[model samples]
Target: MREFDVQLLTDAVRRMAAQSNQILSPDVYAGLVRARESEDGLTAQSILDDILRNADLAAGKAMPICQDTGMALVFLQVGRDIHFQGDPYEAIQEGVRQAYEENYLRKSIVKDPLRRINTGDNTPAMIYTELIAGNQVKVSFAAKGFGSENMSQLAMLKPADGVEGVKRFILKAAREAGPNACPPIVIGVGIGGNFDKSALLAKQALMRPLDVRNCDPFYAALEDELLEQVNNSGIGPMGLGGRTSALAVSIEVLPTHIAGLPVAVNINCHATRHAEEVL
Candidate 1:
């Protein structure tokens, strides 16, 4: 067995949280640049250029790309043979707390849905964990802003609804979320799971690099089709009207019951902030 200090994990998470807020990942930045270059409308091109400039300034200044630093969502892949000195969950939360406090990132998490009390430190990160074969622990961190998150949707579609139903729902969600969720969005889709699992899968899909495609040929083709349809919606950059409405569409799927097909859509703004580390 391999022993690890919880402090190390804490430190790693803290740095990742702070850095991710400022630096746009290479894949996402490239996607933005591509959008800017290909956008035919001068207004949309200008918007994409401004977005790129904002990202550059944020990284150079070590400041958040957006005011909403977001709720910390941490995904952990722990090795089965590894052991930590302290509670993993608490360690991750401590990291989030330190990142928010020390880095001057905005604290957006609230204590309760109904009471609406601010958590102050952004503690109690939304943590998901899985046990894997290796000895290292991998952390995938994302600061999920609420603007796009609030526009997400999930529906338990009948199996008869099939792929066409999924396509319609995704397009409708994008059309409705136009301007509200921020345009040039990244669409993460989850299909073929139960209600909650589908949502989780959708959120997880956002963690994938924009350039990567689903391994399954059918899903990969579906992703291409969805991207084309969404970009053709004329939502444009910031929904001002153009061909660059969406940067990418990613889908993740799992097996489900014979009678039901559940689908979830998670939308992310242009500043899709996420980072990863292995320790």
Candidate 2:
């Protein structure tokens, strides 16, 4: 067995949280650049340009790309042979706390859903862990802002509804989100699984690089189709109206009961910020 110190995890998470907020990941940055180049509408092009500039400025100055620093989300792939020195969850939370406090990232997490009191240090990161065969621990961190997150949708459709139903629902969600979720968004789609699992899959999908496609041929084709349909909505950048409404659509799928077809859409803004580290 390989032994690992909790402090190592803590420090890694802290650095990820801080760095992710300040830098737009390369895939996302590249997507934005492509959007800016392809956008036909002058206004939409201008908006895309501004977004690129904002990303550049944030990276150069070590500042958050958006004011809404977002809730801390940590995805961990733990090796079966690895042993942690302390409670991994607590270590992750500590990293979030330190990052938020030291980096001056906005404190957006609240203690309770209805009570509405700030958590102060962005503690208790939403952590998800999966055990794998290797000896290294892989961490994927995303600072998920609510403007886009609030617009996400989940639906349980009849298996009879099939692909058509899924397509319609996704388009409807994008149309409804229009200006609200921020245009030129990255769409993370989850198909199959139960209701909650579908949602989790959708959220996880967003962490994937924009350039990558689902391994399944069917899902990969669906992603391409959905991207075309969403951009055709002409919602544009910041919802001003153009052909670049969405930068990319990523879909993830899992087996589900025959009676149900659960689908979730997790919308992420142009500043889809995330970082990863393997140790």
Candidate 3:
């Protein structure tokens, strides 16, 4: 078995957290640029320009892209062949703590939902771990802000509801989210699975590169269709009015019970901050 130091994992997360906050993912940045160029409405185009400039300035000066650096969400895919020298999970938390502390990223996490006590260091990252075949462990990290998160939704449809039903719910969700979700949003959808798994899949889908489509032709086609409908939403850049309501729509799916069709939509604004590392 290959032995690994949990500290190494911690360091990686810390670096990723600090860096991701400043540098928008390349794919997402490109999508924003394209949106700016295609927009004809002067107001919409101007908004896109400001967004681009903010992104560029953030990266140049090493500043958080948005004041809300957000709660850290970490996903780990580990190989069974590897053995950790320490608790990898705690190490991940430490990474988040150090990142927030050192980089001055806002500590947005709370100790309790009701009590609303601040965590101070942003410890106890939301972590998910899975086992795979190789020795390497892959980490996926996202800094999820609440503006779009608050607007996300899930609908457990009847199996008979079918594709048309799915489309209706999705469109409705986007329309309702409207300006609240921060327009020119990126939507991550998870179809099938149980309710909880569906939500997790949607969150995972957000990490996918905007330029890549779902590999399955079926889902890819659905993605394109949903994207068009959302863009046609007239929500525009910051929800003023334009053809750039959403930057992209990505879908991920898994088989589910014959009676159930659970779908979750995880929406993110133009700045869908995320990063990944394999170690």
Q: Pairing residues by index, what is the TM-score of model 3? A: 0.99
- What are the Cα lDDT values of the candidates? 0.93, 0.92, 0.92
Model 3, span 189-277: residue lDDT tens: 99999999999999888889999999999999999999999998789988999989998899999999989999999999888999999
The C-alpha TM-scores of every prediction are 0.98, 0.98, 0.99
Q: Which runs of model 1 end up more than 4 angstroms from their true locations?
A: none
Q: Write the residue-wise lDDT of candidate 1 on 115-206 in tens digits.
A: 99998998779999999998999999999999999999989999999999999999998888898888899999999879999999999999
RMSD of each: 0.8, 0.8, 0.7
* Pairs with backbone N, CA or C atoms under 3 Å apart (clashes), candidate 1: none
Strongest candidate by lDDT = 1
